[model samples]
Target: MPCAMAIWRVYLLPLLLLVLLRAFTSLPTQAAARGGADPSSGTDDGKHGSFSRNLLQDKPEITEEMTRGYMSNSELEIAVQDFGRRCANVSRVYSIGKSVNGSPLWVVEISDKPGKREAEPAFKFIGNVHGDEPVGREVLMQLAYWLCDNYLKDPLATLIVENTHLHILPTMNPDGFALRRRGNANNIDLNRDFPDQFFPINDDINYRQPETRAIMSWIKQEHFTASAALHGGALVANYPWDGSRDKRKQYYGCPDDKAFRYMASVYSQSHYNMSLSKEFRGGITNGALWYPIYGGMQDWNYIHGGCFELTLEISDVKWPKASELLVIWKQNKMSMLNLVASLVKTGVHGRIFAADTGRPIPGSLMVKGIDSKISASRTFGDYHRILAPGESYEVVASMEGFTPKRTRIMLERESMNLDFILDPDGAAGQTKRLPRDDCGCSCDDDGKPFLIREAYLWLYLLVVFFLLVLYLLFRRRISSRLARNPPKRPVAV
Candidate 1:
């Protein structure tokens, strides 16, 4: 028996090990054979295509059977147009630009004052950033219809529609959706096509995809306060900094980390069972902490556009069954509404004006400790600064050729209105002074002239005058005591 065992170990054992190794190696081959084989993936620019991790491992190949009930590119456009006509009172449909394959990127602007500038916050909801993640597109359409259907019926919807300009882009990658691929017709990831802060790969504006260029131009044209892009394959509200300077996987937060966290919490807590997530605490995460990726849309929106953006991964399954889309929409409806309402419901909002002309001035806003700045709208001079409530902040409003004004406040749960009326810097005999609170502040108060630059000298003279008055009062008190009692004074002498 020992001799037989020794022979088995020497010969048969080696063969068994070889068989196990072959089985282990064949697993990847089987996976690739199942979904990763795409023949028409080469870019229009004659470059080889590379698939994202979601395309290969996270999501299976999108078959026709899986996308039966989903809307085609043309169908989505028609639905957008139909929504515009149906909700003509509060919605307008316009095309931002076209896709690589010449598909118009339709946008539905829903507001009480659509296409007109108002002293209100503007929010954008971009869906279908990735062509395969069709859930966002469907859910966004549902959001639009729900808002239209419940405009005055539901208080939340009414607040969102009446107070905020809600822009909905259902599909950013129509060509990719048509191809049933992750990237656009050029086989490039739209999310990664934005200019990155850490890496300069996307710095060349000429090389950007058409869809990316459209979004960029839209941001430049409109002053959005905050925005969110919907995605799938995970369930978390992702905030920036998406990539670290060292390119390491760690928690790298943007300058407005607290504000971003609060914004993320608002979405996660509003979602059904999102805050109960076990994978992500509070169902929110910093983007880089999860895994660093450069050139993400979330960070770019914050950095370049001054728009607080959240990359919301709303579904665990990338390409869920079409039947499940409604359920997903129901799950995230409140989150979407609350996120938009947050623009008006919370934070600091106001407009800047020139004191001399009493006209709106397009100024910039900044917080004392936060290393970021946002600009007011050119048309209305309105600015909205989203901050974490229950904290104190020193808000500053500044413009060129005008004196900067600042005020400190303890931001409560409700939103605060703090407008500034900056005086011309060349104005003479005006002492630099800040207003006491968030109420409107101006250089001139009730036709009273402000003090000149010799403020400290005036303070010194006032102190001396006060001292003289105190001395006189003390002498008067002494004389009154003497007059009353004749001082038993000399009695001691």
Candidate 2:
């Protein structure tokens, strides 16, 4: 019985170990199989798979006939093309990206040097964030046309065209507009699709909507100084912080609260009747004070892109009659122009240079009281820092391995032009590089890379484990052979 037990330990034990190893190796495969088993499962795969399934199952199809008078998706595309051709000198139209339903997100860039880069600030106006709020899309198109016609004709228009790059995305949610819904075709709200400060819900880039991703990518590429998204359902201009730390319905302000309030007032006060709103004071409201929401694009722009963005609720009633569209455009036209003009009209505009080399260096600009900073452009070393005017601010310009320069300025109603020539620090010899965004490299998405690294690690472990098992098996077999046939006892000398 003892001999039989030893035999089992040698041969059977090895076989048992092999079975355990195989089971261990198959775990990933089993998990993958289970994941693939239910193709229609409501599991979010970070891309469009899960949402696409949900769209097909739950949402109702909207036909072109249902949306009359308004431009169809194809018509909107045609209008963009026509504008590009008609306003060839002042405007250059381009597509930022495509939506989930494969519609191109078109942008009409209005500038004297339309497609060229300059030391000037850039401002973007995104319309139709929610599909059902189609007023913005229409109003934006009118704004584009007005700019095209009035450029070199209208002083304010020429000012914006010559001094700043104005990018207008007419319909961010074409898929949602086609469906006539608040959310996109996948039933996801684009406003709530951005990365939230208080929550990690939208942190995964893979799970983001194509429209939201497009906006994020565009912001990185353009380096906008300030921006606004046209929405409906209210009449006041909204600014960050869109959410609160405690998740309560209260007035939670961002670091640049004063500046944001000024920006919001620019839009609201410019509007024909926005200032007369009894619901919101001064025709402007803090976003969180009204109602807190997470993953809003307005707050994300301020935090991540270094752009002062306002959520402008243009119309009190969303989806108003088609005829009212023209009236709405007329009402909001000055607000749009003044907002774009604000980048040039009221802000601290400057370029940063290396004192030793006399060459432009991408640096950062900050105000004394403001907690946030804006980066200078790599090509021109130009930075546009928007602040509430008529105040004294100690402006600081900083760069890696350079002695930061500081200046005290009493910024007035007119925009202030200030330049900084940073000297190389004697203590720090070599110049340290700035972050990708600061260095002018486009860091589009924020998705983490741990999954890929983990996958490689598991593969490495599997290869090592298999080799270890093979080595043990070979050793066991050699030991058994040596035990069965021992050499002639070394032929005793």
TM-score, one value per model: 0.76, 0.76
Tens-place lDDT digits, model 1, residues 314-401:
9988888898988999899889999999999899999998897787866889999988888877666889999999999999999766
Scored by Cα lDDT, where does model 1 land?
0.81
Give the lDDT of residue 10 in candidate 1. Answer: 95
Worst 10 residues of 2 by lDDT: 47-56
Check candidate 2 and list the clashing pairs: 46-206
Misplaced by over 4 Å in model 2 are 1-66, 430-493
Q: What is the lDDT of candidate 2?
A: 0.80
